[model samples]
Target: MPFYDYECAECGVFTALRPMAASAEPCDCPDCGTSAPRVILRTPNFALMEPGMRAAHATNERSTVSPKSTQAGHGPGCSCCSAKPSSRTLTRPDGSKAFPTARPWMVSH
Candidate 1:
């Protein structure tokens, strides 16, 4: 059973659980017992939610519509996206460095 909204003339608005087949029909108000027409004003109430929960809901909704891109080359100077090979020099605390590559004549800066 799903919750449905019904507006009563004397009791304002109230919600009731009913089958999908009877969603279009009016439901009896719990307080007044009067038959009230089904309404569409029962949207999710995010205002009463906690700050963190509300923010998470907002982030989820945004990601579903316009998610952040994960493709390469987000902008200039991106280390992983650069074409040039990165340096692999290992240095010690005394400022001395060693190159592990096969180049024997390479000079240290």
Candidate 2:
């Protein structure tokens, strides 16, 4: 089941709920019993891999490398052209590096 976040306009309170598909049509605030607006909430997620799992997966994928690399068109020896490097290094305008990887692709604006 998926959890949904809702906020009550009458009482200005937020709550989470797991409702049946039909029940979600007219969800009511638990506090004031008024209709609450459903809001999308971000939830954290993770995948656990045992030792050597990552390496094993990478090894298997490399066996079928194409004759021409997909990134070859970008540039020779370019970071983006290298087998989609394991991770990206970011440098700020001030010439200082931060975080191991580039900013997430889907960050909220």
Candidate 3:
């Protein structure tokens, strides 16, 4: 059984354990007994994809390499979060932004 969230406008939010097939069905509010619709909530996912878990495992294995290097933005392959080492970041002129560049592969956040 999976725990699901149900919200009643007249009452409040409540949780109930039910089967996956009944997840979409309305649940009775414990307080007012009114029908409450199920609400979607984010839950932790224990299952990992093939290459995804392997990469995370490899990174965890390197935790013993260096104490300071393990810090985020300073470790190898952390260039995405690390600074460019430049004295100052370039400023965008005018009201235009450089983001979502003209590249076809890039997307706006």
Candidate 4:
């Protein structure tokens, strides 16, 4: 059984647990016994759920809607996956390498 919202003429709004088949049918208000039509007041009651349970449900829903893509591509010029080395060492015309800011003992690879 799922909870559904109903708007009574006398009362503002009320919730009732009813079968899915009777979801569209008007429900008798619990307070004044007036037949009220079903209405959508809000989304599912996830706030009332436990923190861990709510996280699990969110993960499940996210996976169902959009699974993480494993084959995302990076461009050749992109720094993260580029073949070029990003070393800050400067190369002189004499073929010697100069490490301006690097530690003296740090050897270039």
Candidate 5:
């Protein structure tokens, strides 16, 4: 089901609803009981790439100095290792540290 955005003219209310494509054009406002105009909203579409396509895309799009590249460059059991302390600390936008306890993908390779 596709979600549609609508705006009520009478009550000046905006909302999103899952409705059929044909019925979305002239949907009524759920709150004010008035006819609302359906608006097209921006939605993200995600597609899964095959392993070969993913590898090719990664090779093309990834920079030479990415974190993964850095991790691979440092030999096994280094600070860049997923099991090390460096990987456990996640930095915030404001330069704060977030201590991650769960080692989801952390393993000494």
Candidate 6:
């Protein structure tokens, strides 16, 4: 059985479950019992994104440097890209730091 949508003059809109062969047949409005003709409806388009994927997409959108901007050297004394992306001055305590590569003490390589 396939679901069908119908419009009734006195009852607005209603749904019905019917065979494909009888999908085009008239439907009775549940409230008014009036015979109403079936109507064609457009299917809905939906996107289901995982939490991590959605978060990553949002982060990418809000990135400080865009592909075009970074390629043209948006920062001072830099073009295309630099060996270093961010600089850190550790006057305060912050765990977030960037190095070109991990040191021997940081990880065994």
Q: If scored against the real structure, what TM-score would every candidate get?
A: 0.44, 0.35, 0.40, 0.45, 0.33, 0.39
- Model 2 has a clash total of 0
Off by over 4 Å in 1: 1-4, 7-26, 30-37, 70-85, 89-109
The count of backbone overlaps in candidate 5 is 0
Task: Return the top candidate by TM-score.
Answer: 4
Model 5 gets an lDDT of 0.64
For lDDT, the strongest prediction is 4
lDDT of 4 by residue, 1-109 (tens): 9999999999879999999999999999999998999999798889989999999999999999977754357544567755686788799999998887899898876
lDDT (Cα, tens digit) per residue for candidate 1, span 1-109: 8889999999999989999999999999999899999999957778989999999999999999976765534765666766887578878899999887738898877
Better of 3 and 5 by lDDT: 3
- The sequence of per-residue lDDT tens digits that candidate 5 reaches over residues 1-109 is 6566777777764655555755546777778777787765654332455778777666766755464544545765675446744476677899886657756576433
Off by over 4 Å in 5: 45-109
Clashing pairs in 2: none
lDDT of each: 0.87, 0.62, 0.76, 0.89, 0.64, 0.71
Ordering by TM-score: 4, 1, 3, 6, 2, 5
Collision pairs in model 1 = none
Residue 92, model 1, lDDT: 87
Off by over 4 Å in 6: 44-109
Summed over model 1, clashes come to 0
Descending-lDDT candidate ranking:
4, 1, 3, 6, 5, 2
Q: Report the poorest 10 consecutive residues by lDDT, candidate 4.
A: 69-78
Clashing pairs in 6: none
Deviation of model 2 at 56, angstroms: 14
Q: Write the per-residue lDDT of candidate 2 for residues 6-109, one digit (tens) a residue.
A: 76777764656565574356568888788887765654232456648766766666866743455546756777536665445566899876555545564422
